[model samples]
Target chain A: MLTLAQQLWIGLTNGMVFALIALGYTMVYGILELINFAHGDLFMLASFLALTLVGLLGLATASGPVVVVGLLGVVLACAIFAALINRTVDRVVYRPLRNAPKLAPLVSAIGVSFVFQNLGLFWGGLPLDVMGGGLAAAAPKSFPDLIPSTNLLGDGAAFRITAKDLVVIGSSLCVMVALWLFVTRSRLGKAMRATAQNPLAARLMGIDVDRVISATFLIGGALAGFAAVIYGLYVNTIKFQDGYQNGLYAFTAAVLGGIGNIPGAVVGGLVIGIVRALSDQYIGAQWQQAVVFGMLIALLVFRPQGLLGANVREKV
Target chain B: MLRVEQARAGYGAVEVLRGISLTVDEGEIVTLIGANGAGKTTTLHTLSGLVQLTGGRITFLGENIAGVPAHELVRRGLVHAPEGRKIFSRLTVLENLEMGAYTRRDPDGIARDLARVFELFPILAERRRQAGGTLSGGEQQMLAVGRAMMARPRLLLLDEPSLGLAPLIVARIFEVIRELSKSGVTILLVEQNARMALRLAHRGYVMETGAILLADAASALLENETVRAAYLGE
Candidate 1:
C-alpha cells in the first residue's frame, strides 16, 4: 500500500496542473459565458510545439544552465504561439456571434476543437526526432527527460519528493499566485471583473468591451501554454489525444467549483486530483474516472450552483 | 449644447423613435415626459449611443455624433445614468466610481470628481467598501448618478431617476438634479412622472406614441389643459 503522505504529494502535484488549465476555462467563461471547447486542443497543440522546439534546439541532452535557459525559451515561445491562436479563434469564430443566440458560438467552439485535434494529429506525424521519428502518428510521443529525477530529500525517505515534482508544483504555484495578484491589484483586472458583471455598464463607463474580451483570451491561452510545458515535463509522455481527457478533467474541475469564480477552480482541481490519487491506490487505475465522476454527480445534486457559486438564480 | 434632428431608430425593424427631434442648450435641464411605450427612454438611449440611429442626425458641441460609439460619447463628456440603475453589482462602490473615470487619464481631476460624488451622496462614501448589490434601491440610484458624476460630464442623460422609489427618495434625487443643473451640467431627463419632471425642468417636451405633442416652458406645460388631462392627475 502506498503511504498516505506519498499519495498526497502525488495528488497535489497533479492538482496544480488541473488548476492551471481550469483557470483558463473559468476566465473565458466568466467574461463571455461561452465554453471554448477548443481550449483543450490548444493546450495539446502547445505541447506539440514544446516538443518540436526541444528537438530543434537539441536540448534533450544538454546539461546545467543551458537546460534552464532552453526550457524558459521554449515556454515563452509556446505561450506567445498559443495566445495568438486563441485570440485569432475568438476574433474569427466567436466575435461574429456576439449577439446571436448562445448556441451558435458554442457549436463553433466544438468545431474549432475538432480542427485543433486534426492539427495535433497532423503535427504528431511530422518527421521530428523528439516524436520518435514520427513512425506512428497516433502513438504517444515520449517527452525528453530534461529534469533530473533524483529524490530531493535523499534516496532513503519514505515520503519521497523528486526534483521534477518540486519544479512542477513550485512553478505552478508561483504562476497561480502571480495571476491572483494581477486580477486583484491591477487596473485591467478590475475592468475584467466589471465587464464580467455587466458589459453594458462597462461600456457606459468608457471601457472597450471587445478589448477586454481579447485580453481574457490572451491570458487564458498563455496559461494553457504554461500548463502544456509543465505537463510534458512532469508526465514525460504525451499523445495527440491527451488534450481531450485533460480538458474534460479541467472543465469538470471548473464546473465543480463555481464556473466563474477564480479561486473556486483551484479548489475544485485539488479535490479532483486528491480523489483520483486515492481511488487509484484503493480501488484501481481503470476505476479512477468512475470514482471521480461519481463524487461529482453526488456533490452537484445538492449544490447545483456548484461549491463556491453564489446562491442567486442562474441567469440563463 | 446637444441637438437631435429628426432622429429615427429602433430594435431590428420596429421603429421606436420615429423621427423624434429635441435639443438641450448649455446649462439647461430639459425633461421628456410620457407614458410607457412613448419612446422617452429610447430617446435618451439614442442620444447616449446605446441605440443606433437609423436616420436623422445628432450634433454635440458642433461635431456630428450620430455614428459615435457609447464609450467614445462618454469620453466627449456625454454620460448616461441608465434606467434601472445598472450599477456593477459585484464590484465595490469605490470600484464602480473608479470605472466611471475609465477613459480619463487625469488622476487629479478624477479625485476631485470622486470627492464631489461623496459629498452629494454621503451614503455612498460610508458604503464605498461594500458591494454595489448590497445597497438599497435609493442608494443604488445615488450610486448610478454619482458614477456618472465621476466622468465629469458636460451633458448628462438621466432615464427614469424616480422609478420605483419612495416619495421621499424621489424628492431627494430631484433636489440633487436641481443642484447638478445649477452647477452647469447640461441635463436631458426622461420621466414617467410628468408633474414632478415639469416642476423641476426649465423646459418640457410631452411625447405620445413616438412623437412629441408639445414643447414649451415648464410652467406653461404644467398649466396646459391637454398636458394636465393626459399626464397630471387632473
Candidate 2:
C-alpha cells in the first residue's frame, strides 16, 4: 500500500512537469491549429539556460535563502529568454506562412525544432563549470542539487515526501491556477479566446490577431521555461535529446486531452504520468512507452474527443 | 462618411470587385442590393478592409483608407458586422459585446454603449451569459448587431442582417436599423432582400457582376421598372 502511495506521489510530480510543457503545445494549437514541433526542444534549451545560470551564480554550493532567491532569478531569466525566442521565431518563420498552405507552417515548425536541437547541442558544449568542464556535448549533465532532498515526513516514513516534491507540485499548481485566471478573466486573454474561435470575427471586433498570436507563443514559451527549471531540479539530469523524448510525451498528453483544450491538457498529463509510473513499476521501465501509447490508443478508440473535451470546442 | 472610387480587388488573380465605386455621406443609410454572385458582399468587405484593393482609392472620414488592415479600420470607427454574422461562438453574449468595444479605451463611453445595446436588444441582455453558438438564428443576428453597436460606430456597415430569420425577426432587426439611423449613426447596409432594403434605406445602389448597374434614391429605384423587375421580384 505504501509502495503504491509512493509511486502515485512520484507520478503526480512528474505529471505536473508534463502538464506545464503540454500547455505550451495546447495554447499554440488553440490559436494557430499548428502543433509547434519546436516546443519540446525549446524546453530543453531553457533547462540548459537554467544550468548555466546555476553555474554562473554558484547556487549549487550555496546554502539556505540564497538558493531560493537565486533559483527565482534563474527561473525569471529562462522564462524571458525562452519567451523572446519563441516570439521571434513566430514573427520570422511562422508569420510569413500565415496565408500559405497549412502544411507550410507545420513544416517550418519542424525545421525550427531541428534548429533548436542543434542550438541545444551547441549550448551543451559551452565551457560552464556545471556542465562538467563541457567535455561531452551529447552527455546528460547532472543538475545541481539546489533543492534539498530532505524528506518532510522524516527518514522512517515508508511513503517519503521530499521538499523537492512539494516545490514542484506546489509551484506547478500555482502557475496553472494563475494561467486559468488570466485566460478566463483578463482582457487580452479574452481576446486570445476570441481569436482562437474565429480570427476573422476577432479582427472584425478590432483585435490585432497577429499580436494575440504572438502573445500566445510568448506565454506558451514562458510556461516551458518554468517547466524546464522544475524538471531539472526534480529529475536531476538533462540532455540535448531529452527534449525529443520528453517532448513526444508532452505532445501526446496535449492530443490525449484534446488538442485545443486547456484543462484537458492538464488532465491528460496527469493520466500519462500515472500510467508511466505504474507501468514502470509493475510491468517494466523498458515497456513504459508501449503501455502508455497502448492506453492512449484504447482511450482514443472509445473517446476520440478526449476526457474533458465536448463537441462544442473552446480552443484557448 | 465613406467613399470608394473605382476600387478593384479580388482573391489572388480572380478580380471580384471591378472598379466598384460608391459613397456614403454622413448621417445617411445607404443600401447596396444585388444577386448572390454580384459582388455586393465583396464591396462591403473591401470597404471594411478585409479584402485588399488592387486599384483605386478608399476614403473614410476624409482620410484615404486604402490598404488599411481590418482591425485598424475598426479603430477608426468603420465597423463591419460580416455577412455570416460571425460572432465568437464560444464566447458568452456579454463577452462578444465587450470584444466589439475592444479598440475603444473609454470606460464610461463603453458603459454607455453597453447600456444602449441592451436597451436596443433586451433579448441579448437576457442571454448575456449563454454561449453565442447556442443562440437561435434570430438571437444570433441580434447579438451580432448588438455587438456592432457596442463599438459606438459612426459608420456601421451591416451585411445581410436579415438572412435566414423569420419575417417577424427580420422586421425587428430592420426597425432597429432605422432607429440607429435616427440616433445619428451612418449606415451602409447590404442585403439580398431587395424590397425590404429599399424601404429602409434612404438611397440604394444596384450591383451586377462586380460593378454598379444603377445608383439612385431608394424610392426612385423602387419605382424604376428595371430595378423592380430584376431585384424586387416583380
For all candidates in order, the CA lDDT equals: 0.89, 0.91
Tens digit of lDDT per residue, candidate 2, span A1-316? Answer: 8878888889999999999999999999988988899999999999999998888899988988999999999999999989999999999999999999999999999999999999988888877667843468888888988888988888887778999999999999999999999998999999999998888889998999999999999999999999999999999898999888888899889988988889989988988898899889889999999998898888789988878873244332
Q: What TM value does chain A in model 2 reach?
A: 0.97
Clash count of each predicted structure: 0, 0
* Each prediction's RMSD to truth: 1.7, 1.7
DockQ, computed on Cα atoms, for candidate 2 = 0.61
Candidate 2 positional error at A63, Å: 1.6
lDDT of 1 by residue, B107-176 (tens): 9999999998899899999999999988999999999999998888999999999999999999989999
Candidate 2 deviant stretches above 4 angstroms:
A310-316
Which pairs clash inside model 2?
none
Best by DockQ: 1
Which of the CAPRI classes, incorrect, acceptable, medium or high, describes model 2?
medium
